[model samples]
Target: MRVKRYIVNALPEAVSMIRTDLGKDAVILETKEIKVGGFMGMFRKKRMEVIAAVESGASKQGGTELPQRKPSPEVNAVVEQILQTAQRSSAAAAVMEPPAQPDPPVSDKRMEREQFIINEIRDLREYMVKLSRQQSDLHALSEPMLALKERLQEQELDSEWIDKLIEALSESEKSADRVYDRVELWGEAKHMLEEWLQPYNNAEISRDARVVHFVGPTGVGKTTTIAKLAAEQTIKRGRNVGFITSDTYRIAAVDQLRTYANILNVPLEVVFSPMDLPKAYKGLSDRDLILMDTAGRNFRSELHVSEVISLLQSNEPNETVLVLSLTGKTADMAIIAERFSKYGIQKVLFTKLDETTVYGAIMNLILKYGLHPTYLASGQNVPDDIERFKAGKYVELLLGDAEHE
Candidate 1:
């Protein structure tokens, strides 16, 4: 490679000089603006000093032997002078003396150029530091990430959910003073929470000639759950269970519940108005348990929700189970919980677990509101899919291990 330097009054001139000296094979290595000495350095001119190197293969004079190169004293002197000027400027700036003439404030253009260069240098330095930090972080995280990945795979967690779990783990790891210690702490907390969730399972309300109402939004398994509980009390427990449906809003829903009631050999009453709720309960008062099923109204519609809540309030069921679907978004679950919270939703019944692959949203809902889940329904089976709430089972399911007793 051939290296050379050019000093000219303008950048264009410097570029032209390098191009001419090294033909078209020149590669600019560095460029700097200088104040040329003219009239005792008072009348200064902008100059460009450029160093360029040319590749050997690209040289026009192919395999020709060249004479030994000699360094230019002028170039060496210029570099030395630049270094000395930098050192002197550093020393002078340290002393901090006021300038006599103030040297005329730098032009906006020059200031902008200098600022751009400074900004570029700062950005480059920051980028380099970030790259180094990321490298170290990746190296440190490799073992944990790998361990987590292996654990998740063995637990049969879907790959799509791995990123979310990893993110949660990473956040926990960062906030922890000691990662291993934090893991132990988190494990203990999880176990305690699981233990706390155990007693909440048998949410079965015992009523002797008392009206029990199940009310919530659409498709939350309100009708089916009413049938399930009604069947369990009537068939398994041998309680005189009577089913009442104000779900005359949907004839199909009424028919569905009536079918279940028929199978259980229980009396079924279909009511239309608020007045009908009391009348229906009175008709079934001869029975030991009266399970009233309400139509699934859209919770988002305030007017409809008010209507449902008004019905629930009028009936005043001993215990109201706010049926919430587990498959819904966490925000939607929260809104539903809040909406029904007014209706005195004492316990939460999460349904449709079999339909959803993710259960973290369930944990988020329960933890966010400190909700106590009354029961969990996994499938469409009346008395089979439904299981009492168990926090350990839920935590295991959430951690990608669904098979827990």
Candidate 2:
């Protein structure tokens, strides 16, 4: 048999090329896609690959004997790259191409208005195609993966992060050449989540930082979190603890910290401004650990965030932790985290875990803003309801028990 390879723009083009090169009797033995001609392995053009053959005697011109072949590692890599390029090119062409004009190009007042309408229609078409692709991708997942996706979406994870996870699972499916069962899918998700969060894991509160400041938006359980940490340091570790309240903005906040202080027999100092921080620190100088609680305001405002950051000024061995609530929306939390992150605050504490089941915000905050989570506060039962952040356990809670799914 005589074989010929033809690279063309499409199947019809390939058929035409084959008939002209190898005559009408040539049969299409194999057909696939490939890419060609690019600088530094990018900007390559997509083309169809056709392998055709004809009987040696029928051709009246012989060809080399055919041999069975399999892709080596390098060839496999090129194939994978070609598949990716083809997919991207196909999606872009489908989504971005404008409809063909019915008439020759012209410029006029009416045509200008018509062009604007056409552009708007084109944008709408792109949006609709985007929605259709999202729906199709979601539908492509099996029941287990679909359930996991729903769970993540319900937990308020960003769509970008969700797409990344689903894409990973889909790639795994391709690599294994089989669909993963529900348990396997869940397990894979859990493993991937744990792997991602592992680097930020076990970020416990420093026992050595004499001054630890807790800052957050209003009603995020900052004062309560302070009390919990104080209780842990004072009762569990048998270390001397003190409290300094810059939360003088609220009478209830002062009274609340005092109540905890009175119960724990820890000294409490109240500060009205950054000026008062010096006096407060002096009074708590003898204490092994001084936990400072800042007033939670509309930290969403950059002005308020700056006001809070100014109050956090401390010359001693100190670290600031940005406290966030699980009860809050991820977008708002992200804004708050972003505001705090700008001032070099990296450690985070989450509260109100018992109030919300959605935990994707934890991962989002950690990965998005590079905030290291130190503790998870669940309830009001001082020190008892809180625990240090562990990536493995958090992954279990975030993804649930994989096998049980």
Candidate 3:
């Protein structure tokens, strides 16, 4: 795919520019309103910024061509009749002009305008309904497609993913039988889901990495997730694990990590400044694994994110795990991920899974950002609540089955 961006005064102008540059086959990926030519945020002109993409070989092939259809004799007769009727109506209106009278009440005029708009909207809706009915047979697989879309919406999947799935299924359905049973349709959907999720199946954290840092907004259970992984390394893998916390902003964040360190019999170092990070790492140099926890703040603020980045900069070859809460809004998750992306985030860690049933955000994040999730923390059960991420089991849960062990 080849992507390009265009900034224009209006959406239509942007579309025209995209067609001229990327051809008619170009797909609009994103669009947003932006301010330009403003001094200190005053008197700025609002403009539209559009991101468009086309297939790599689209230009060579002259883009996608529309199929030509010759109009039938009956259709041409109908069109000619409609044009003649419109011409007659226009001539009649022009010839029969009524004498001007006093203007009607302003309220009556307003009501008539409002009623006209309402009628136009109603007519448009009815026309669209008729059009859909006419094309229903062409879209014979719409039943299964609608069912899949409804299920995905109930699962709270992102619209982008749901639309992509529907598009893919629609293409596949064209070759299938005219009718489909619910079981067969569901089997096909499951197979498609598995294929879509296959790329995210590998979520294992590298054992060779010695330093792991967890960063995210407040109340995402970063410290607890680190503790869970720490326990897994120390007890299950028999690797020496140590704790380092730069989360002094929260009242009990340091103490919380310190408690976990005490329980695991590992050294805990609390650093107040970025300069203290080197000292803290030196203190835990002998350990096989060092887990670092940074203070959670409003990631929307660039200053706060920069502060966290400064602390993590000292730890070379460190894996930054961005912790996200499933209970939070997906829109917020997108913003958090975008802001924290400056830190070179390598892996994602989802927490509080037991608190919510929806798992679409997990898949959305993985697919959208290409971030591999290493662990999933379902509850607050110290080490027991966390588990390695498995794509197949995750998809099963999304399909409304209980999580498999």
TM-score for each of the candidates: 0.55, 0.71, 0.66
Stronger candidate by TM-score (2 vs 3): 2
Between prediction 1 and prediction 3, which has the larger TM-score?
Answer: 3
* True-structure RMSD, every candidate: 16.3, 15.7, 15.5
Q: How many clashes show up per model?
A: 0, 0, 0
Q: Is candidate 2 or candidate 3 better by lDDT?
A: 2
**Could you give the candidate ranking by TM-score, starting with the highest?**
2, 3, 1
Candidate with the greatest TM-score versus the true structure: 2
Q: What lDDT score is found at residue 386 in candidate 3?
A: 90
lDDT of 2: 0.78
Best prediction by lDDT: 2
What Cα-based lDDT does every candidate model obtain? 0.63, 0.78, 0.73
Could you give candidate 3's per-residue lDDT for residues 1-405 as a string of tens digits? 999998886544564466568765566555456789978989999886767778998762322322223333422332343344334434454456442556533355344534443443344344434444535523544555566666778878898888787667666666773544555656666788888778777777777678887889999999888888888888899999989998998998888988999999999998999788788888988999888899999987889888888877653566778899999998889888888775678588889989998888888887888788888888888789998888777877776531211
State the lDDT of candidate 1 residue by residue for 215-248, as single tens digits: 7778888888877787777768788888878887
